[model samples]
Target: MPTERRIGPARERDRLADAREDERAHAVIRNVRAARMVAGRADSAEECSLLLEMLGLEPAAERR
Candidate 1:
């Protein structure tokens, strides 16, 4: 039977780093939205907070 090689520790770490970067990108968007609210240009801080929550993230919590 043909088998595939499993990822080693380094590759696993790289994958995790990539996932973290993706999450940070999302956080940046939320941060921008929250900033807009602070700047008096938007009225959807609640909506932005909800988006973050739906992404398995919570505003004001440390990123995992």
Candidate 2:
């Protein structure tokens, strides 16, 4: 005979929390990429600066 393992409510809740965090991280990445694309196509430095500021991201020069 063999015993089976089961997930408790606590473990389930932890798993859900981890999944939500992963989703939030992925959303942040997507938003950053989208902002980069828009910034790349911006007509002027001022526009790019404003877009980066609104997205709460640093400029490319400062990232390195």
**Residues 20-39, candidate 2, lDDT per residue (tens digit)?**
99999998888779778978
Off by over 4 Å in 2: 45-64
Over the stretch 1-64, how does candidate 1's per-residue lDDT look in tens digits? 7598989999999999999999999988987676445435425777666665655545564549
How far residue 5's Cα lies from its native spot in candidate 2, in Å, is 1.4
Q: Highest lDDT: which candidate?
A: 2
Off by over 4 Å in 1: 41-64
- Candidates in order: C-alpha RMSD to true structure: 8.0, 3.8
- The lDDT of each candidate is 0.70, 0.85
State the lDDT at 27 in candidate 2: 86
